[model samples]
Target chain A: MLILQKISQNKTLAATINQIHYVVIIGEGLVGGALRDYLINTFNYKFFYNVKTPWTDKTLIEAHFNELKTFIFEKIFNSQKTELAAPSFLQLSFVWSAGKAGFAASFTDIDEEEKDFHSFLNLLTQIDQERPAFVKMDLHFTSSAGGLFEGQSSVQEDSQPHPLRPYGILKLRQEQKITEWSQNKSYFHGVIYRLSTVYGRIRRGQRMGLISIMLQNGLHKKITPITGDLYTLRDYVHSMDIARMITSGMISSHKPHKSPSNNLQVLFGLSQKPTSIFEIKAIIEFHLKHKIYIQFNHTPGNARDITFGKIQPPFEVQARDIRSGIKDVLTDWYGAHT
Target chain B: MEGTLSVSTITPVYCGAQYLEELIKQLERVRQEWQSKNYPIQIVESIFVVDAAKDDSLAILKTISNNKAYPWIKVIELSKNFGQHPATMCGVLYSTGDWLITLDEDLQHHPREFIELFKAFAASSYDVVYAKPKDSVHQSLFRDWGSRGYKKLIAKITKNPFVIDFNSFRLIRGSIARAAASVCGHETYFDVAICWFTNKITTQKLSLEDQRYINTGTSSYNLFSLLSHARRLIVSSQTKILRLGAWIGIASILLSVALGLHFLYLKIYDPEAIPVRGWTSLYLTLLFMGGLTSTLLSIIIEYLSSISLQNQGKPLFFMVDRSSDALIQKFLNHEPIDH
Candidate 1:
């Protein structure tokens, strides 16, 4: 009877501490790192990252879940331990798994591709199932706007994705699963950020982008072969801008979840306008103050190599100028080399 | 001819944003004049290779290219500032016309005089024609004299009289220009590469003005830039200069041998005729050593020169398109040449 009464009091205390929100980030990579730093520095939200492993050890996965559960419980009950007050809302941001290789792999690797898909699905399932039961859990997922709408010139939140590659197909499937799961639950609120081509300083073991490759070649004074033609255009956004948009969308009072109309909202996260490969090369060369020798290969054309239309982000955000962004990246690279 | 021949004027721009507008205006005027006069040639495109200028030259060029009135204007922004010659080669590679005329972006090479060069090519049946200024060039006296002296020296050394006629403002057949540019390496002087392909070169006299020099009282070529040009010119030429070293070594050795024999003959005849006791041996030793050193140095120089030429993509043999001459003649006469 005494233990039952204590449980009843604990439930009342948990409801009182529900004013504070906790954000759990799944992947800690280039975009994830930026988003994690942004959420902590801007909103002072408590941050937790999922343990990264190959998922071969069931004991390791269970231990990780137990550790996360204990951390969340302590944050809710022991408010005096941390610098910030107890959490009211819990926001979970997922930004992991999948890259260019998933798209570039041939049909002969179907089995491997399927394995990758299942691994991602299983990850999401585990997260959804094992989330803290004491608090209201909000989810934020990042999907690729460029990959999903591969050959399409212009894409919007409502545009039906006609994915051409396996990577895009897998991304679309993940989006569908998240959307379906987010619906039919009043307590759940989710935001899907469809990101454009993100360019920034990639962390170690992170997926490399064109900008990073060009900058690295320029710094080393090496020749960089262009796989695409001069006219291949891409919409580039700084990773920090995406992080800021995600955080701002979460904190705003008129968020998608707060709306009486819909529980799930999709937003595009694009910073800079569309730029071509030729223009990007010129900008990088200008910043480096050296000539980057280029040899054009005779590779067959890719379907996604078409020019992109103007990008319209969901909200207004300060976009960094590409020239200065290149300068900053080159400067950082020079620092590292030196 | 299936259609009238088209011409492209390629200008490599570097810190010439201030003069770009005026340059384009003059080029447009020349194009309009050619069309109105019923000339068989049309200025199809005016390609400007912007060599990553420090100024706002690229933005100005973008504005001009975007304007509907200047549809023929095509701007190619290079990855970085490759000097004037490489930039010109880049423009040449991008050109698509029957004839390509390269000029400076400073408006010193007037577009109005292109007709004279075309006429010169028609009359002489030459593959390339250079526009030589008839009047005193509007450069400072020092630069003008330095340019003249340098050209004369290069002509004398390389034994190629065509070096004297080389100028920035020139007309070349598009096919040959692209071919030469393709084989041009970082050290290859563009005009010297053209010379390697053909000796059929001529010059047309035109009155010219340098408005930029007249207004600013300073030319872009400094002492260092002049030295760099001289180095490229000497490197691109055949190793005739090194051959001169070998000839000198041989001549000295022959002369010294004759002198030594004469001294020995005199010693045998009469010891009283010797000027000093040990002077003959000392002089003989010095002559032999000097001649030997010169010979060895010349051989080393020849070997190094061959290596450099190979690195510069000097071909053992190249085929010239004889059919282009017939096309040029047809374009000149405004009638198709019969097969």
Candidate 2:
């Protein structure tokens, strides 16, 4: 068991009295990986159990979830005994940032994704049923802003979910499941983060973002075919910013007066600025210091301009500027390739 | 159906809850129509700026926008009722398209007419295209006559030839539209500001009927609003009407001088023709004083008009790129646009 204490040099982390006993991350994809990194480095949490299962295989996935439930039960039981020996506050967080489908996913793919999501929800029910009385549970579910509000522009905070594809429908369904789960538990604090188009460093075997793909194609001197036209707009937020927001949200929720509640708080994770594909291409080209060829395929149904209105959420962090972020990603890519 | 040209349609909603759904449905049809015909143009987004309606228009707009089918519907809510021009300006600034078409929320301007507007725009080197009503819009003869007569009279008075063509149903180049919107102050009339940017404006004849007025026998613009609009338009424009005052004053001074000369001739050459002892002198003095006052008032108005123009943030010059006109031309010519 790794007992991690706050470093004295890091004043911000040291100042907070948050004692998160356990954090179970359900996914290890781009967003989940970034979040885990933040928790270990910036957030300074050592106890973590990463839940990974083949989302497509129902039997194996269910068995894996059962094991996860047993793991959590034993850990909490031990932590409770330790709390009696030394009086302290304990917090348990379940971060669900997993998805196996893209916006252009087929119906079959979405169905499998939906099944995996249901299994995860079942596990949550099991944990909620047997959880200790004193342990506060904070559930953070990652929802897609692009999927929920596809082809929409100037999406307000109160705007309804208008999912275009099956992938979007699945995301909405997952959010509904989490909302339903949190309804009965008074100790359950739920946060649904509707993330806009997320761009970041691409990990191997994971889905690549437009910016990352553009840089990759540019490096290989290959022409990238865009399914959307130059004028298509989207709100892109970096994944690290999403991590910061989620951590901040958890910290804010644990304050004395701001205790756990059954009612789920919805927050839009967005940059609040709509960037056009043309502008993005220019930015990439400027950073790459070369003109990259892009052919606009613009598949008729795939081209939808999704933009978000200005929303200042309570847990928002100062978002990294798109230009500098792109530059950093490019530099990282260049370093790795070289 | 994808094309190089993109268009954004802006509608300012105020007490237009009844017609909004039908308006959106009609726009959808036009969107589908364009896509089916491969019209080399796409309706990128439809922006509805709700200017704080007294009714449940905003709620209905939200409901309509959230339907998943109309994902391109963007709603902008003002803090309070900022009137139509400001709301329209807000929509224009939010728009991200190659061209912008502004229409009423009352379903008066049918979305199908956009084809005609687009055709006219593509055929000419115009920056703005206004849909000219083929017949009566209000159905009431008096109202129609009044609307036309007011526009013509304003056009003559202000010497703004485009005033007669200033219909709410208009297609403006996106760059020009946004640029015009950016410089607009609180009281700046939107159409007047547009005129200051580019004079390449044309009109397309279309059959338009104000369905709301026809059904309800009332218009969004009552007599008070129209008058207010006229006053704003006059104020926003560099009106030649002010110069008319100076011209009239000069004519008066000249007339008074000629009359004074005539009176002097009568006094000197023909003494018997004089009706009274000092009548000629008194009349000449009054005429001269009246002319001087008129001239002084005109000069004062001239100074005020200059100040008003400056206050309105009238740009010294505006730069626009008409390079996309070639694409529209190709589209109009039925040539393949992708190449």
Candidate 3:
């Protein structure tokens, strides 16, 4: 009987200890960071990697999984982890667990066309060698689902994921790769969730999106250029919604089946209703109470990602409408920044 | 109308005893269905290549062959214990047919899918028919990702756009099978090399019957076995130097040097505009790079497995312990294995 262990990049592994284990996650990008926060806040889990105080609020944000920092680097990165002395301090905060890993390795700006998707798969392979775990979900991009399965059109029962960008196309190929891998039965469960643009309050100078960039422009009264038609639809869900869906599905006794297969389920993350970029701008403008000049130039952005028909989960939240979500963002922003 | 086929196939008696019986039963159903469909499945031959099984599986296989009466059947027991792939090759080497289907002893690949593969092969102009899994036979995300990574890497090596199949099931023409086996000499992976060897490939997507893992019972490929498999396809493939060099140059040293030169020039010319006036950020940067370099170095080092294999001139597999060269002769004396 050979005992196996998965030494995850998260410094902390996502799975409960298994007798034989393997875990695979890649990039440790924005969504991945939020996943770590979900694990820390929801489970009150501690690890040996980083220097940061534990998170208490049920808020979600993203960060990379640091293998070297363990529980040691959390404090180093989170100088405020000890200074913020109360539970009421939950306006908006995050403790990044930095490590000897490449948190500061810089590279020249890459051409948008120069990215290699195959290398991304290879990097995933490298990560798996450190800790081998069956990936439950492949959080990436996609395109059409070829045709209907069991009856419903893909966009109706499944995520009708037709991604328009090269990045998303790479992600689509990845999803295909994951599905095929799951088929090979290398001890892997295949789950993929195509997420909407994740949004929430953030400490400026991070990300290039409507929420962060718009918030910055609104604060500075800088004119923000609108990409594409102002009404381009985006299924922007709360970062918490992203966190909630993943944790619940993974830990839940009954793993949600996209179909009865229990092998592959690809889903889309959205509110009960779809929201457009223009609608988001209106909400932010109304709540922030500051109307920065809107330079409307309709050149288009993000290959116009295809939409999906809403599949309501039984545990759906009445869910903050666009207006409410904007308020939540503004309130969290003011409280955190101030 | 037999839309599906059931046939009892066996991986034979050897160490695969753990997996043989279940494989036979799965194929038995497929074989039965093929007959019921009135399908023109050239003469069906039940094949068993008994390499020293070291367990009851071989005996069980013997018991099975003794008890059963069906189409033309033959068991080729080697003189000693040869591994599964070599034994399989030995079985295929002598197969008398225009097409040959090979599968693992593990129950991950259901033999019932032969009809689907056969039908797809019939419908297409392509010589190779690949049965793609709609999902996985195992439940781990890491292994799935790693397997995918391996496929991509091998694809890169061969410069052949690989149409990955559910490696557990595939059907190829007799000529292609022999050709692939010849080119793969002593390499652990036969499936991937086949992909490298072929240009025309088609895929048929199918789903696993839910209890895939429990059905396989336990995998014979332990952690070491899995890694070795990865090494064989990626690191030990016929072309590693050019691929490895291109990869390292593109990924690591070149980028590192460019960054280093840029930072050095920045520090030497304009000390006033140094991004880091203090040493804290510098220390953090150093720690980060130190770790990154070490990790990448280790990755590059792992690609050296082919060197060891070539140096010893050690063959990858050896045929062993066979009791029935005469039985194989006798079976052939009657008719071909495929007959």
Candidate 4:
């Protein structure tokens, strides 16, 4: 057995594992940043969040990954041992499961979607290979539920994923590869969380997240158009709720003697309620105390509506109502603007 | 006002996010000014083709496009960092206007000077009008001289008359610009494609400043980028230098043939006139071999040049609109010659 011990500190591997939980979150975009903030503020976990900086060359990405690996190793080696029981290593990554829509717009062109999947798989492989020694690491991977299991009215953790779009197909492939890889590793506790339409206050001018787009347009007094009419339904979940559920799930259970067959687990991080675009717009208007100008177009490229099953987590997690979430987002956005 | 020609301005952005806000503001001001004047030419859209900039230029472009003040702003985020010319061509392909203007995202090409270019076009029948700086260009002396020398060399080598006056800040007719852009391959020099389409190209003198360089004290283009541009320019034009090689080959062959005939005449008619009998034969043999080698090499070069020109879409014959010369001469007489 490879024992990872702190050379400078008087601590055994098992004792150190019991003391502090080190979490490394990769791709510090909207979702990753929110999770980091929630974990730090609520649970006070030590985190090594890797934020992508603007790079001009390909070598910079490799350099950054090396730096992150060194940092993770050093953190694991220097942590003090305690008597409290907790998992030692935790890794989370937020990836663009849908990729750039323009590249995957045409269903016939699977090249870009394939490229996104390969890169995603490569990152997972790197994580699996570069994890700290002598520690059972709990790896929580987040993917888009809506983007993966497309054309389904209701989706569950065990739903037969039949994706119609190239983006969805690529995401499903990534999930399968992760599952296969996790089942082969005994010490790796991999949980795949398929999140629904996540919304919150994002950076201004960001084109992602429907809620952010509507709010930015409203603030700028521009008419926002809803493609494929207002009846497009989606399970809208707040980023805060997502962060809470993920953190709770990470801290909830530890089964040490689990077999390779049961090493990988799947969860749906979704709100059971499904809201239409019309309802969302109405909620935003109520929160902002003004009517947002909206127009609907009969476009064919809108994402197929999806419903979520009950979010059965090992621990109890409460999700904010859609209206309250919108209110919170608006308050934050308004505060930032003012 | 209804029948006025609409214009679309295209700027290929690469690491110019710092000045993007000011650029958009100036563009908006120009649009408003044109609207107030009831100008016959109106800027219908300002298309920004962001070539995966190293900075947050895409974000800035998105912000500008989202602004309510500039309804005509369009941002095209390219998947990769294609060079400026290819990015400009991408924008031109997406544009819908009567005329298309291509400029840099940096304030080097001032938005206010669109009026001057418009006036120049109005005065002439030229389809393309380039805005050339009359005073010193806002770049290092080395860069300015290097660019001038490269352009002159390219013009002389390709026998292309319009390349010497080629500038990024140009106002081109919409249909011609789009058609030219559509035919451009990955290796096509965009300016050469414009020249291939029309010879009715002229220049307007302007006093422009590179504000970005002034602020940052650094240029976006370095030695490597200039060399890449030079390579593209040479590849996209016909190799008149190769043709010169072919001419030299033909002249050598002719000279050798004339000398051989004279030697044969001397051997047949005046046998005693050759003082050194073996020397004459040796000299003739050397001349024949040298001529043969040069002729063969030149032919190979000529063949290679033809292949390159074919790939570059060089047509055997193209129609020219000579009637535009009268309007061009009139415009020239009215315009002041730049020193």
Candidate 5:
């Protein structure tokens, strides 16, 4: 109670008000952990995530609702603290993570829609419950690419979700949903980043980032049995740069100012420069200083080469080159937990 | 085209016991036609989803259960009747095939069209082949008008100029069908969902003869029910009201001014039309305005329902573990390995 009062009155605290937002990432994957770090130390926001689960456990159904309720009442409402007073700077700028997005989609595997959809709902359950007043960002990543290459660029903010696969389609539908969820809610503002392909994190799981997989295998001097094709390039950006850009967005809420019709800002977060698989392989090979075997089935068409430079919102940091990024990730990989 | 694609024929039977005989007759004929001609597609399975049928549908299925004559037939009896769409969704939930097709059990939509749907699907890159009713013999003028009007109205509202021939009789790529089926909600326009899930949709024209035996079969829908379905479709499939509201809002402004001027002209230029009874005009004005206000309120509620559905953390569909083998394996791989 005393801490809340003292913090509210503290000008120094208010000055860095852009640093006070918080979030709970339920999926403890690379993106989830990165979002947590950005919100805590980098952005310095406070948050509470109720649970983390592997997949479709019956427990998540309850955990989702429970944490969402707590966020709505105890955390979000309590965070506001004053009436009509402009939130301190830290509370603004941006609050987002380009977490669950798929690059390519196909007609097979409709069940993925069910699984990916739950994550969206879990997040929404949190969004609806917390209805945060101070924070202005409800940034999410939906499958924007599926609807793009499926004949035309029908992936507008209002276009129907033409998901080739269940994952991309569900994610695309989630874009419409979050837009609808944030509308007239009066609590928090929203912005969505249509991230291309994020690299740099050295996550070790079955669903590890593709770049990490290749780099990891190269570091270990093994052959990476790559899926899809070699020419399949994506707008891969380093995680730290992505985080820095997100922090910058949370700090400055200008450019595409908030609106009722468009509180949901959509940005295709490429590195302002794209990286292809061949380049990525070369970079990894150079960085590791080893002869990494090259294996190409074919270059997949999942990588989108569309334009996204119009709403190029400013960021504070630069994304690393795939070559340099491979070295950094390798160093971090061995540095942590090794 | 090898045309060897197997078909999963699904029929969502509500209180449609009367239509069962004709529906089965059509299916039997279709089975014979495809088998005899060696049609490119083979009958993978036949699913009769009888939801809450008070009639002897369970008894009917029992009569056929032991009969080895029908190569592949699956009867799923729901504990209770879950309504038309839900019942249909239940069948979709149970179906397993490369191509999923549905038709009205009332026999209004013939089984002869199945071959056409299959042929088109096999010969093209289209993910979903949308069937349009080329002719309707059994529909009354009122029903036809209602159907056409609803189509146009929903199209205007959704802003997706859909072909008018949309019905239960259609063939969808198995993947698209499952994708649309996965997000199955209690209430959804299944056809619109198909469009939302696919890029290539081919439209085929067909003719329907009159369905005479609809009397004994119970119709759970009235005009009010029709309106409700239309309401649900308009709400879920499209976000037309904000634009509609803008148009109506402008119209209201224009109408209010025009009415105001007319009233002024009447009061100033000619006092005779007023009837010298102040209560009449006052009551008339109040009545008109009251009705208009109610219409506006209902529109607002419909918009709010869409917003709530969209915003609320609701899944498009839920999967039951009754019969999904592939899904089980996929789910396993996604989970953490014990090692």
Candidate 6:
């Protein structure tokens, strides 16, 4: 009964934002880490991401969100420091980049990620319920283009998502759940970003995309397994470019033209260049000055081509080309390792 | 090919350093011509696949591609030479357009003729339109005759009537081109693999000249490479000749059986009707053994062909969207196209 009342109260809050005080990141993986780095170092924004907390654990996740709430409240309400110009309405921006499932993930793994996502959402709901009536909350969920649009060619903004695997289904469900969770809560603004094949940055213990894996393996002269055909096309976008776009979107006060009834903006993040594995291999080999050993073992998940068209305006950001991006990534890896 | 429809031009480069500059110049003129005319068509990208040519082709291509005058030119340099067909396939796989046009690097196929190819493709419901040379491509009787004879003989052998019409200068529907290129294996002939998807192929006659061949009496194809091309084409095709062999084998077996029965009847009824002493037994034995060998060989060949096709990644059904082609047809017919 208490939970029901809290949910009902949270659903009715009006969304009016004048300023943002606290920026929080839920996941610190590839995209999350890049976003966090950009916000803290580049933009000098007040971004909070707790690495020690296990977000997937149901019991600990609630406590983690509570701690985050306390941290934000202390920084915004208790402190004299002004994160932003003093305004009547203060808002909180949450960038949810927390997903453990990938294109090749099993059903069990995807199910676990879904549960983690729900727990995270429940915590957000709790925050909304307990927050002062003046504060607004915005969420930016990083969805997967490779998953949601797998087996699709020339994917446009209006293309209907037909998820072929559990990973894609989970992504689609997350998008729907976010929409539902923020429904009628004008105080909640949601932006769902469907990102294409992201590659760059070699972080420890975090999974990397094909480009990174090929570069890392190339340095060691290790044989890389090719799971897709040589001609399978994909749109590759850099992680930093994603970080830049998300950061700009979060900071910009410009809202979409859509009605505030839903208060949700769905955008596709892509480079709009459909490149093939054969081309990618050639580029990498050219940059590395040595042939990267590859063994072809086509997988069901990557058997089809997933190419994205030009992203719509107002949400589009210039993405780095694959050739120069690969060069930069390889050079960075080489500098760090050798 | 339609309102805001994009096209990509691909050239497989191998020892054409001298012609790269002129080729780019011509392509640029075409690109400008299309833009100024506003024919609802755009040359979105021009891809050059450098097949690790033995000359200065790669260097020249890189320099020209990096020039600000031709920003749409994309140069893909392979680590090693993968031959012309593979290089072209590599470029096709990288292309993102509604239509794809492939030509040679030596400027044998003029960029001006691109409009002719487009008119041909748009005028019909064909997925592939080849720019057939109305005159001799090399203007050398021996060379032209050899090329024609080669295609004719291969077409007769493989029983694919479209073989004689295949040319390097072609305009292929982008989807079919990419699909075919995607399925091409190391041994799969790119043109033959493309035919597996759609049979809506046509040809447009165009006056073309091999300037390099005429200037230097040398061409990209030599005796060895021509043989290799023939082998690859035949291997990639499901030759009807093999089926004919099987039928012939069965007919021979039936005829041998009839003759054996007749010989037995003659011996039983009238021994004097037999002209030779052991001719019947010898003749039947040879005929039966020959038939059995031919039948076994044909079955083996058929099984091998099926396995080869499967390994080549032949798609069961490829979906194509011709809605854009309608707009292209309207534009060609001087009808107003909706933006």
* Poorly placed runs, candidate 6 (over 4 Å): A1-25, A28-195, A198-338
Give the per-residue lDDT digits (tens) of candidate 3, residues A1-338: 00012233353443432211211222233444555555567555343233232122112111222332222124322433354432121111111111111211223211221133333334334433433122222223222222111112113543344543334444455567767654644333334555555566554554534665676688778887765444344455665565565544443312343342335556655553434454455456555655546676645343132233334541343334555666776776778778
Which pairs clash in the backbone of model 1?
Answer: A18-A88, A19-A88, A20-A87, A20-A88, A20-A89, A21-A87, A21-A88, A21-A89
The CA lDDT at A159 in model 2 is 87
What root-mean-square deviation over C-alphas does model 1 reach? 12.0
Candidate closest to the true structure, highest DockQ: 6
Real contacts retained, model 6: 0.14
Whole-model lDDT for model 4 versus the true structure?
A: 0.67
Question: Model 5's DockQ?
Answer: 0.01
What is the C-alpha lDDT profile of model 2 across A1-338, one tens digit per residue? 11122223455554463644466777767787777777788766664454446665677988888888887777564655574653345666778888878987888898888888888889888878787666666778899989998867667788899898988898998888887777777676778999988888856567867877887888778998888866566777888888888878777666777754565889898865566565566567656666678887857556666766546654758677666778877877778878
lDDT of 4 at A129: 75
Per-model root-mean-square deviation over C-alphas: 12.0, 13.9, 31.8, 21.7, 25.0, 14.0
Say which prediction, candidate 2 or candidate 3, comes out ahead on DockQ.
2
Q: lDDT, candidate 6, residue A148?
A: 91
Clashing pairs in 6: A14-A187, A15-A186, A15-A187
lDDT tens readout by residue for model 3, B43-136:
2555677877676666776677666453234566678875666676666543434456766665555676765666666543455777777776
lDDT of 5 by residue, A228-263 (tens): 544333456666666665555544443334443435
True contacts kept of 2: 0.00
* Candidate 6 residue lDDT tens string, B51-155: 988899989987877676665788888889889999998888778867899999988999999888989988776899999999988989999999999999999
What's the CA error at residue B290 for candidate 5, in Å?
Answer: 99
> Which residue pairs collide in model 4, if any?
none
Name the TM-score of candidate 6: 0.62
Q: What TM-score, over all chains together, does every model reach?
A: 0.51, 0.57, 0.35, 0.47, 0.41, 0.62
- Chain A TM-score values for every predicted structure, listed in order: 0.75, 0.91, 0.60, 0.78, 0.71, 0.86
Runs of candidate 4 with Cα error greater than 4 angstroms are A1-338, B214-217, B268-279, B289-304, B314-339
Angstrom error at residue B265, model 5? 99
Candidate 1 regions exceeding 4 Å error are: A1-338, B33-38, B139-141, B322-324, B327-339
Write candidate 2's Cα lDDT for B1-339 as tens digits.
234567889999999888889889999999988878767678868999999898889999999887776767888889998999999988886776778999999888989888789889877779999999998988999999999999999999889999999999999987678767766777889999999889999999999998878988988899999999999988898777777777777787788899989878888999899867987777777877777888898889888888787666565665565766887788788877764
DockQ-based class of model 2: incorrect
| Angstrom error at residue B166, model 6 | 0.8
